[model samples]
Target: MPPVSQAPNPTPLYPWGVPPSPPEKSRVGLMAGIIGGVFLLIVALLATLVLVGKKIDSSYPPAESTLTAPGTLLDGHYKLAKDDSPTLGPSLEKSWRLSWDAKAVHGVVVAYHPSGGDRGELIVTGMYGRFRNTGEVRSRVLAGNGSRHTEVKVIVAPMDVTPSGSRIRVSCEEVTRSWADGKALSYPVCAWADGNTWARVAYMTVYTARSLDLESAARITLQIRSEMVKPIK
Candidate 1:
């Protein structure tokens, strides 16, 4: 009656010196935790993007940015001076003031510095013309603005850079004109017109050595003519 020889402690065998495998429960928990962490991280990233997008969207002008005073603002081309590139420079605060008279519509947008001052103006004017062509409208604009301001240097001629399928023509010139900021700003007055109306888009870009592609102006006016004016019978 000797003590029964105890069987050797039967632990799972490993091929080499590999550690024992983790329990199934532990492994499952680890996988779950990893998956949960990844899900949460993705959600956080999406939420952050949404928040940022909302903030950016909220930057829009509180009130519909008015164009200089009161008349028919030809409906067609969207915002010329956006909060984006090219049209919008390095300024912060800006708005387009709209106003018009009997036969015309005007738009004036200005970007201002944070410190308090003016940046420049992106202006558009739409004038109602029953059966006038681009040349007539262009001539009228030139004569009116010229008579009003004497400071100018002929840089660009009233070229026929009109848009395709549009009777609008593009005309640009270099001049120093008075702005709302009470300063004489220099820029090229680019304008375009069709059979129905004429529009101008101006920026404080002085040109002495070169010219600008007034196609944008023409395109804008073209849209206006297409949308606002009815086709002739």
Candidate 2:
């Protein structure tokens, strides 16, 4: 009997010609890893921001100091005398005598009574008598070292005195702009007050400027308030 011819073994297929197994499982795992990494990164960044905000909050202290000087009275009776310019410029020059009744209205009185003006122009023209019963006033707060000084921006609100009584309350907001740091800063001593015939008082808040510290701002505010006196009544 003729030996049955063995069927030629099928040639092994080349691996290169075979379709590769789909990497579906690996792809799934890789995606999961990428997503987890992004989530973790975001959480870390948020935590960092929280820590930074807390640090800033902790830096400023409360403003408890009273601005009213002892023995100072605000009963609407006093005199104003013109004084030489403290710093030389075009600003009107004047001082005060305790005898004048601080109620009479004058152009200078009306001008400085409100809370807006140019520093150079303020020196020359005095304060403008725009009389802002509403809106806000911008004031300067002093900060930084003696050699390197900075200005802090402050906002003051007008008060309602009454018919025949001239009374205004200036409130300082915690928000502040800085000339030195080129950024806005906030502080805890965020509130301050100056009313007619009353001591100026400052209230602290929970924020402060990065460049212009709260203390510096308060000092500058005090100086500005001191310069302000109502015309003799």
Candidate 3:
């Protein structure tokens, strides 16, 4: 006869069954971390490559002691006003100095006041250096100027023969124009590389209203180089 049977503990129905399992962790944060790490690694690798390239470029042989800018060129028509100046200024930023990386560099700013004193003050800036590859240096030097202020025409033509009728290792010319006092002025930039020496020349004159001749500027550069770069005996 026994007491009434105790009701069995009621079990939870489907909706209230055992406690739900813990939620799975999200992988978004992990994935993002991995991607960031990879990107940083790639950037570091690129930086290392650039450093190696710069080191190789600077590993060229020592420059000859005699390689320098002369005091005078073109029969004293151009006189050296400054030698090895601390900086080349904005004009150089548009030309060789931007891309010029060499073992040794010599810079000179020449002043030209014609006998008649009618042409105003003409300046020639020359940059000489020692490098490994003539073509590479020449190309870099020319590319530095790019298309800035070059509205007339973009000329990067090869100069097979110089004024002396002798073949040059590598030569090129770039022409650009600018306005001064409501007058258009021209700048003829030239680059020449030979042996282990590289040179860049630029013509600037605010007094003259006429455009400068490219061929003549290139010839003058050659003359300047000839006088400056002497045999390393």
Candidate 4:
């Protein structure tokens, strides 16, 4: 008796002409796609950085400027005097100034009571970057060779407020002193920084007085800070 032969398995075939994809090749393709996506993301980030840099350059005002003349003040009560001659530091360079490399600006403004006689004084300086040791720095400047009255440092109120949605900080210094005529004097100086701008204002007596109007001095300083935040036209 002969045994029946087992039938051989037939080759598999699909209705359409299709080829099987290699698993390794598929994996390599997926990896390539991921790398491409990452490269695109990096390029987008770099473009965003360039845009931000442009915005800052266009929006921020020039840190270096001559003193806001007494007449330019919003109140319009103060005016520069011919003989007073407020000192303006070196003229601003034509080149662009960045916040990190910008230098400080120094200038002066003098005023009179309009009715008669001297009406106190206002001085200003602006700069880029943060301010520190303000009290000490101002103290040294006040004790200049020309200051007739000895400036005695006193208490100052703490202020932390931003003007025009800008970063700002304020400080005050009160001192008692005597004039050439031996009249008791009150000097309250207020200082503040708006972003890269730093300014100081002091209430001086045209005539001998007992106490300085600190509130007025502080008010003026805050006003200056607000202006500093605005872009130059």
Candidate 5:
């Protein structure tokens, strides 16, 4: 009889299924966790970038070698000829041109110069014994400023012949660097092949007064290859 007093509809406990609100502390803790995770991810990414940058900076060609010795000038004319011999190596089978401009600069010793005619778009240089068939050979060809730097360096026995039969290995470290004036920039590509045989070539402006863009340098390099010369003997 007491309960019969209109049970008040049992107050419908929690308004039929509405879940209770989460605690403020719990919500704050979840937000903090998300923020902390994001912060850690950013820190990790930054650390990786720093490490990669350091590696690249250290790997660039060293500049000290450039300022040491003044390179010898090779301001002479040359001629080209055709080479169809099978034993001359693929590099020489193209057109072969030869010039004698023995010079020394920046510790780089030059042996031969090729103004390419049919040798492909490349210039091959023979370095000193540093590139002799034994130690190491560093050689390079610069097409121009901002152009691709092609270098050939190797370490081998004292009398071994290089892949191109150009030079032997001694000790070599080849590199290509850039220089600029107000109008245009120049790239000097240098390499050391065998002893007493080094090579250096630059794709520079035909006329120093004019701008020597990258395209021009590339074209010049191609011309040198097309007119490359080799020793027939």
Candidate 6:
């Protein structure tokens, strides 16, 4: 019998007759790796943000059980007068009332005349309450400043202040507004918040020559807040 003809060897598709992975499979693997990497990165970022938030929350000032009126602050440079007048005008008061909670703890409007015979005054209008949202309240107070007044010129935009104790968050502004006497006067205004207590301060004077810078105004606010707000026992 004739020997069976051997089948001709087929041409090898690759060097060792083994083909590489398909292009589609390789693409799928690459995409999976990229997606996995992105997922991990996002998770890491979120974890970091959480850690930072926790740290910030821990560093905040201790919560107070109630608000206080210390009557005076800054070594008697400021005095909480018995007569709480409407020094900030009706429109601003209305805005504050709308922004703050109705059942707030302590609300007051007092003017601090220069302990000496000076003609300038610092008006502090504020209230203490549990703020549902501290940041929103602060922003609203800042934005609503001089809202209905057309003759107001902003001299210093709102800015944050870090006082010595780090017990409060303070923002300040400076503006020139037309007075009822047909003259323009500059005012240094500041807002203070500590998640529980909030205040608005305005330094006003008819003596245009005497001026208080925004830094001074912020410092004054810090002193006032430190004196007025006390941590619960």
Best by lDDT: 6
Candidate with top TM-score is 6
- Model 4: which residue pairs collide? none
Candidate 1 at residue 137, lDDT?
A: 56
Q: Which ten residues in a row have the lowest lDDT in candidate 1?
A: 92-101
- List ranges where model 3 is wrong by over 4 Å: 1-62, 65-67, 82-84, 89-101, 106-111, 115-129, 146-167, 205-213, 231-233
Question: What are the models' TM-scores?
Answer: 0.37, 0.26, 0.52, 0.44, 0.26, 0.58
lDDT of 2 by residue, 75-151 (tens): 22111223222442123212211212211111231111112221110111122221212212222111111113235
Off by over 4 Å in 1: 1-118, 151-154, 178-184, 205-212, 215-233
Q: Write the per-residue lDDT of candidate 4 for residues 2-97, one digit (tens) a residue.
A: 999988987668656687776565778889999999999999999999999887555544453333434444355444443233343332211213
Q: Cα RMSD (Å) per model? A: 19.5, 19.6, 9.4, 10.5, 18.5, 10.8
lDDT tens readout by residue for model 1, 101-158: 1122233233211112334444554443232334765765655556545554445555
Of candidate 3, the 10-residue stretch with the lowest lDDT total is: 89-98
Worst 10 residues of 4 by lDDT: 90-99
- What global local distance difference test value does model 5 have? 0.33
Error of 3 at 170 (Å): 5.1
Sorting all predicted structures by lDDT, with the top scorer first, yields 6, 3, 4, 1, 5, 2
lDDT of each: 0.47, 0.33, 0.59, 0.48, 0.33, 0.67
Indicate the residue-level lDDT of 101 in model 6. Answer: 36
Give the Cα-based TM-score of candidate 2 against the true structure: 0.26
